[model samples]
Target chain A: MRATNDTVSSRIEIARAELTPIQFATGLLFAAAIAFVLVFLQEPLAHDAMHNFRHAAGITCH
Target chain B: MIVDYLQRGILAGVVAGLAYGMYMAFVANPLSEYLHDTQHEHGHDEHGHDDHGHGHGHGEHVHEHAEHAVSETTTALVSIGSGALWAIFLGGLFALALYVLEPALPGPDGIKTYVLAGAGFISVSVTPWLVLPPAAPGAEQLYSIESRLAIYVALIALGAVVSAASIAAYRRTATRHPAIGVAAGAVPIAAMLAVVPSITPTVVTHPELSSALVSAYRALAVLSQAAIWVLLAGTFNWLQRRADPATAVDGSHETLTTKQ
Candidate 1:
């Protein structure tokens, strides 16, 4: 019983040690990915593309 | 797995979109309006001397046309929509990368995790500049080269600060105490709130006030944004703690086994 408890406790400690960093790192990566998408989405589509869509819909930038 | 990635990506997108939308509505839009109104009120009245000035006909006509086309609403909508789409796409990529790298990366010391996180943040913020279309010929450049350079520097700085704060907070919380980390994390949020008003110049109709206000506003805005980012970093760190697999027990098995 004592040996079993000791092994379990040691394993928990090891796991805790391992998981914390991974979680933090993963969080950072997630933040970065979100930032990238935001920047890309801001780019203006080509005038030709917008014009085509507008023509299809019977509208214009003017 | 794909569904999970999609869900996470969408969640990230929503969070980013909402945050950016609120900032624009509450902060940026008002500032833009103030600047526009002020510029109109104190604009160059002395330039009406077409009789004395050479080439006045063409110059005055061009200036008048430029002034008429300057609409704040149009710019705001474009900014908001662009922000939302970017967040979604970037969020998806981040989620996918995490899913792949989680297995191979060692997290025992926290350094590798922090580095990866910082890299992710920097890459997403700076990469879009490469593919962005050139500014329209007659349209004043939205992002000046100097401003773009500043943004790149700022993104890297912000990532480093957030990463450091997160790691420190996590380490503090892990050693059976949570107060220090919580307080440290909270500082960034508070700083953001306090700094925004200062950095954001009040739009006044007077030329003399505009320059000073703009300078102050810029400083405050940067500080406020940094604070918000730090707070976000802390919150993410806390979530990571809650999701830590070590502390969670498997209900299916009667015998407790430590699962990595």
Candidate 2:
């Protein structure tokens, strides 16, 4: 049987509520991975690599 | 599995950060260098620009350029790495904020990207700067460190709070009357501007550096931030389009009945 517009809309609503956390989690994972780049590749990047976030935030720690 | 939109957003952010960081490292002129060079020139001039190149041998100018600044190779390496990290931070920031505001965002990805990018710039950079203007390393602090930190944090906090409140209000009210939603947004914006006098600009006491140089440096700093947001919005949007980021239920029945 073909799904009505009402049926489809309700389904999307339920799916979205379920997916928000998942989407956010995926984004967070990606962010963590990016941070790992600096941590794992410490030998090549030098000191400035770690403080890049501070600079982006306009903080002058030094 | 439909493409992981959030993961792609993170990847996009990392790429944007690297792009900005590299721009900052190799391409973007370092404000500190300008300050250092100007200070050097001023000191040398005061003593007298001696005809002989050996004049710097004495005690007056002790800062050997080679000793203080890192080597070119080192600087570039550090710069690229840092750029990547910065991009990632920015990317993650937008991704989260956009996710929260996704319901309010319009469709078609094209128009939506502009709104997302513009909002990202405003919330992340503009609102904060209204209270805590961006500063270069050489700039003098007009206030105490604690005070500066407080204002910076407050401004950023205020920015986030206001945007979230305003968007939620707008969306909620728009159902009955779209104009009411537009009007509702103004309240949070007004609250954001409630205290402006408290924020004083940083002083640049370095006598040698010209105002133009200082202005240009700060502009570059702002530009660097703008670039990151642009990159994030452009790249992330492209990826999200490819992934077909799930649309949120905006609470508008008209919109609801029209699409799926």
Candidate 3:
């Protein structure tokens, strides 16, 4: 039982320890896109659609 | 792995967003409408005979009522639809942040999840709130929307900087002086507060709305946002554990036992 526990713990540690560079870059790009849509995009209809949420979330919106 | 993380985030966000929409419809919308109505009443009083007086005829009044009904339905639908979409976006961001920062953040996965959630709240909501607090519909505005948004974007970037600096500080100084690490982390925020004259420039429109009501609205907004972060973190952590057979919580798995 102890050996089994050790194996499981080690496996979990290995899994948790690493994040590849490609993964990091992908996350960064995805996050930036979401930020742009929420904060920067100014098309009239899209702006109006998200207006209430922008306000509710405390983002600066008219 | 990235796809799995993104999927979990979307699922969590949908759950939180539905709750957020309900909050906007039932709690926030009514409060804003009340404040808006009061503002118009004040306007009517000041003018002594305004557009509201023009709508007093019986036919016009019924037509106005119908218009208001339609508008209310539209508002509720918009709140739900947009709430879901925005929450999903935020959830994806939150997952990505966790993915990138997990290696640097100390502690076990569970603790790190909550710490990330707190950081998310600070970066996304609390930090910008220092300068641009959540305001009621009738607040006196000093800046245009463009200026406000520019400032907001800058403040959010600053928030991310502060979060990273604080984490780096703690990591570097933790063995020697932990308290000093905390103070160092706080230095940027303290300096900003000192330099900025009107940190919280929110002002309720006078003679129409009370400061207390505005405060309540801001408080509710913060609470709802906090709820989203909490939900995101909890859901993501649960999903991670479920996906990993080695860490499975269920007792049915013979190889992965909870008992020591």
lDDT of each: 0.40, 0.55, 0.63
Which stretch of 10 consecutive residues in model 3 chain B shows the poorest summed lDDT?
B60-69
Please give the distance, in angstroms, between residue B244's alpha carbon in candidate 2 and its true position after superposition.
Answer: 3.7
TM-score of 3: 0.71
lDDT of 1 at B77: 61
lDDT of 2 by residue, A1-62 (tens): 22223343454463465567878688579768867864574342344333333333455322
DockQ of every model listed?
Answer: 0.05, 0.15, 0.19
The list of candidate 2 runs beyond 4 A from truth reads A1-57, A60-62, B1-3, B29-32, B43-73, B104-116, B143-147, B165-208, B245-260
Better of 2 and 3 by TM-score: 3
Q: Between which residue pairs do clashes occur in model 2?
A: B17-B83, B17-B87, B21-B83
| Clashes in predicted model 2 | 3
| Candidate 3, residue B233: lDDT | 83
Q: Considering TM-score, which of the candidate structures 1 and 3 is the better prediction for this target? A: 3
User: Which rank order by lDDT, best down to worst?
Assistant: 3, 2, 1
True contacts kept of 2: 0.07
Question: Once superposed on the true structure, which residue ranges of model 3 sit more than 4 Å away at CA?
Answer: A1-52, B44-70, B176-207, B248-260
Question: Ranking under DockQ, best-scoring first?
Answer: 3, 2, 1
Q: List the residue pairs that clash in candidate 3.
A: none
Q: For candidate 2, write residues B89-208 as lDDT tens digits.
A: 667666655555444564434545556776667666767667556554333344544566566667667677677687667767778887887788667776666655345453223334
lDDT of each residue in B4-106, candidate 3, tens digit only: 6668888888878877778777776666566656666655433222223223233221111111323544655665677767677788878766655565664
